[model samples]
Target: MIELSRRALVAGAAGATVTGLLATTMTSPAAAQDAATPAGPAASPIPGAYRYKVGEARVTAISDGVRTFPMPQGFVRNASGEAVNDALAAAFLPPDQISIPFTVLLIETGRRRLLVDTGNGPGQGPVGLLAPTLAAIGVAPESIDQVVISHFHGDHINGLLTAEGTPAFPNARVFVPEAEWSFWMDDGEASRAPDRLKGNFQNVRRVFKPLDGKVERYAWNKEIAPGLVSVGTPGHTPGHTSFELGSGADALFIQSDITNIPALFVANPSWQVMLDMDGVKAAEVRRRTYDRLVADRMNVAGYHFPFPGAAHLAREGEGYRYVPVMWNPVP
Candidate 1:
């Protein structure tokens, strides 16, 4: 057996070890700088890419873009902005505004190129950068073997089509939560939904219409891809799902829309978001899910987190805090 250093032994004592830890330690600072590297006029903003190895697999978080909006009244359905601001203050963020960053991960497991959730498509202001970001990382959309969607929300599924309403990933198979597909595709559900949600219903049809009979609906607790198992996380949308990606003894929870803005939602999970289809259910899921994350010391990749949204969950006073993972350049 290979000898282990005292430090390594202690860090790995829990049967968890990050691959290339030494290389990450040595190159992380430089990597952080590289993330902010200036882009040429024609090049999309430096793709905000981050890479880490999970056992033998390579996971890269590619930023689509970010959107900032004024805090809408009832942004937090159950709490006031002042109350939410306190949570934001604790996270060192502005209390009056919200910034949502979209990130999609590319997982290369030697056998497959899996993309977890496509970002907002080109129409949503500067948020549709996923395509260009992928290009910047030397990955063409067609090269992806699978496109996995966590839900049917516009921001999550709009990127499925291009500006001209074409399949963005021509060669890849698209997989989405069965419940999401069922809910969105139901005319009866759409008819009863509020006016604000009617657009989402139509948008879902527009995005999926071109791919008729091609979309694959997956259920909870199923392995949509190797090492990628879907966990039923509802309320944000009836079918919203989180993923547990395990490789050997390492794992990462892709918490898709579990919380929108970490400063507000993650820090004050009890506070409900207006975007949640079922506010009470969302809060319950958020509280219970985050509690487990804190207790288990799981790394999470949040869809709306800051760029390259990988972080460890830490228990704070009432809720929890997100500890961002340091950048690793050499991986």
Candidate 2:
């Protein structure tokens, strides 16, 4: 063997280190395969449905999915776009877009099943998932005993019919507020309705015309079903209504579109959504309803709230804060 210079010895060591790294990399077959292959498509979402109890009544919250779109210029009639963006940001929601969720409630007491406000009917983009969601939870449309509507809004009444424009709930007795029936079913009102609302008037006819002789009109302050009383909370529409369900000592307030996306209207009661037919009256109704809810410590279920939207209200600053009720895994 010949004596080596220090430079030659250093080069040999460096070469050895490179060889070791190469051998390690070559040995990792699994890693190489993982790096070579792209990830598979994401799994489908679980069926969106939840069940909980309100006293003896079993209430099921069925999600109709969400609609996300760029925020309209006049989304908030009373506030500027910049202010609306700020409010959205404060709620940890992304700016420049609005995501409105639709939730439908099904209350079962004794042998009767009453569905409150059908969601957007089938075939409407991300919406109209109510039928499938209900099916997933084993609730057949025919099993529904009564379908009590909160208002005449399309999202609230569209699901009354099927994709083929037939009654979805073939065996259910459909109930509409007397006031709502009077407003939307009036020929004078239909003729005089603004350009924007003309479509709503037409849609109301489309939905109710099929159930004409069969529709049952119920008045405010009446018991539409067992342990359920209708409460008129208008302004969002001329005849918008809410419901109070009481059993024993427990109660729940079904606030239907009283405040769309509580993150905005609930936090700022004075701010009005463009959907409000009477913006001023809607604001006033919102504040009044919220005050009573806070005072009574009532549990509330909202139609336009996120999935499984059940919460309690607390007065925060000038507005109110919605404290979501904890999810009960078992009913």
TM-score of each: 0.86, 0.86
Question: What TM-score does model 1 achieve against the real structure?
Answer: 0.86
* lDDT scores in order: 0.76, 0.78
lDDT of 1 at 79: 85
Candidate 2 shows a clash count of 0
What tens digits encode model 1's per-residue C-alpha lDDT throughout 47-131? Answer: 3566676666678777777777887888888887788888778778887888888888888898689899888886665577777
Structure candidate 2, residue pairs in collision: none
For model 1, state the Cα shift of residue 250 in Å. 0.2
lDDT of 2 at 84: 89
